[model samples]
Target: MIEKRAAQRHRVFKGGTITFENGGIACIVRNVSEGGAAIDLDAPVTLPQSFTLAIARDNLVRNCRPVWRSDRRVGLAFVQ
Candidate 1:
């Protein structure tokens, strides 16, 4: 695959929350960087076009849009 990220991501194993206006789901943060992150769900899920990713352990929350998705993982890009 061609590298397209503005910053490089590093491997991680943190817990995360994918939250929308109505609800949320638990996820595993597989990798992360300043610009974005890759999170794995228990299974493939249909999420909103935009949502917030909350990593309580890191005391971080970012608004993001899905850049790509696979069977269980989603690639996210941070939004303002």
Candidate 2:
């Protein structure tokens, strides 16, 4: 089982993208919290234990790490 640290979750439906410097892909934010988010990717990528999320237009970028993942979904937790 996975442990959750969020007190509340906020749903996100905006289009987004993910990149690993060498390549980039499109994805969608399933939901978000102050500290983390879940994403739906069109194709799966081998995620690092920790990475960064660039939120377009908001000028907000975050460093996050994978907490759990499946074939299409991944849960990310912010790195404090």
Candidate 3:
């Protein structure tokens, strides 16, 4: 297998949420790095181009964009 990630990700199992102006959805942080993260949603849901990912315990609120997605998981890139 080829490693294509720009940065190494750390495994995590923290609960989080994706928030938009309209609403939010529950998700789990599967892995994370400085550049991006992999999240698993409770169910398949359409996400906007940009949104905020909040992990309360970690005190993290990052602006992010979806880079890739499958059934119930999404890969996100941190955006300014």
Candidate number achieving the greatest TM-score relative to the actual structure: 3
Per-residue accuracy of model 1 over 45-75 as CA lDDT, tens digit each: 8999999999999999999999999989999
Cα lDDT tens digits, model 3, 1-73, are 9988989999999999999989999899999999999999988898999999999989999999999998999
Looking at model 2, residue 46 earns an lDDT score of 89
Judged by whole-model lDDT over C-alpha atoms, candidate 2 comes out at 0.78
TM accuracy, model 3? 0.95
lDDT of each: 0.95, 0.78, 0.95
Error of 3 at 62 (Å): 0.3
Over all chains combined, what TM-score does candidate 2 have? Answer: 0.79
Name every residue pair that clashes in candidate 2: none
Q: How displaced is residue 63 in candidate 1, in Å?
A: 0.3
Instruction: Give candidates' CA RMSD values in order.
Output: 1.4, 2.8, 0.7
Better of 1 and 2 by TM-score: 1
Model 1: residues >4 Å from true position, as ranges?
1-3
What TM-score, computed on C-alpha atoms, does each candidate reach?
A: 0.93, 0.79, 0.95
Error of 2 at 1 (Å): 15
Give Cα distance to truth, residue 74, candidate 2, Å. 0.4
* lDDT-best of 2 and 3: 3
**Tens digit per residue, CA lDDT, model 2, 1-80:** 67556457778786666666567667788888888888998877787666677778557577888889989999888777
